[model samples]
Target: MTDLAALRAALQLQWALGQEILALVQREHLALTEPGQRSGSAFEFFRQRLHLLPRLEEAVAALRRHRAAWQQLSPALRRSDPEIGALLRANEDLIFRILLLDRENQQLRLRHGLLTVRAESHPHSNRSTSGQFSALA
Candidate 1:
């Protein structure tokens, strides 16, 4: 039998991590708006976020695997498990919030001229080798 309670706890923990990531993105947006208000160096901010990615991915993958197992059960079994259903709904809501915040952050970055460029686009350009500051920066 699937352990509904353990799955629910995992979902809740994932939701909490999602919330934390959203908060971090918001803080980054605020920092971009107010340069002097930045909490740390850009390297530090990126490092912290990168550190969370693997753990977050693991939790999400685990939840999906457990959910798949639970879904194999009968409808009556699913309906009787109110806590699992509620937690699943709440986790979905958290994911939506995270996506929205991430989109907003991307838009803000674009507005501020932080556009991404492909390395292949400038193959032979040696502007940096000429002892001049890069306009790209």
Candidate 2:
């Protein structure tokens, strides 16, 4: 496949992974917010998030592998390619939402006296300069 095609595919994969991560976080929030939620359920949610974080990291790694190719394109070309631009924006939005929900979940978990897990516990998770989670480019 061409470089553009490869990058496009990578973005698609990252987007899908990010969507799953976001949904999982949202569910964790729901589980935490439930007044009758069992500790076991909360722990299960935490474990699922841990396992998925690494997968998200790998997906992000794949996305970054194509960053160079994306950077090689001219600004005008990138602007004109709606599919890629929209997909990238969608992935960024997902990453932001996951971070927000995860933060709220953490706070809720803290109120419940349950320990919190950090994404940094995963060796491969990327960090953006702004300290938010890395968004797939």
Candidate 3:
């Protein structure tokens, strides 16, 4: 017996938080691109301030409980409730996009690391042979 209005509001809040996190990721990506930029400080700050992300599993679990309760509601209630449906759909899309972005970011990081290692290991070997010493000298 969940409060439908409260459940809907919680879903909306979770969706909003996800959208805010996405915005932060975009900002971090921009900061990551500058040649002379170091994101260590920003990352540390975010690590301290964004601890909510780790606790999101709790929020997600709550949402699941609420969703289950919603599902057990009468069919007429579900059909008549557009706000709940919209909130669920938005939250689902946000979570899916977050997962997709995480995978893409990991792949990009691996590729970048490989490229850096290759570049460091294989220095330019093709030196010009214009300067020569004669054995006769």
Residue pairs in clash, model 1: none
Among the numbered candidates, top lDDT falls to: 2
Question: What's the true lDDT of residue 42 in model 3?
Answer: 47
Q: Which of the predicted structures, 2 or 3, would earn the higher TM-score when compared with the native?
A: 2
- Compute the lDDT for candidate 2: 0.65
Which predicted model would earn the best TM-score? 2
Per-model TM-score versus the true fold: 0.69, 0.71, 0.64
Which stretches of candidate 3 lie above 4 Å from their native place?
A: 32-42, 45-50, 114-137
Ranking by lDDT: 2, 1, 3
Residues 77-116, model 2: lDDT tens digits: 7766668767776777777788778767666765676653
Model 1 whole-model lDDT (C-alpha atoms): 0.63
lDDT of each residue in 84-136, candidate 3, tens digit only: 97788778777667555643433343344412343234245442111110001
Model 1, span 55-128: residue lDDT tens:
65675666677678778878988887878877777776766675566556545554665434442245466532
TM-score, prediction 3: 0.64
- Count of clashes in candidate 2: 0
Please list the C-alpha lDDT of all candidates, in the order they appear: 0.63, 0.65, 0.56
Write the number of the candidate with greater TM-score, choosing between 1 and 2: 2
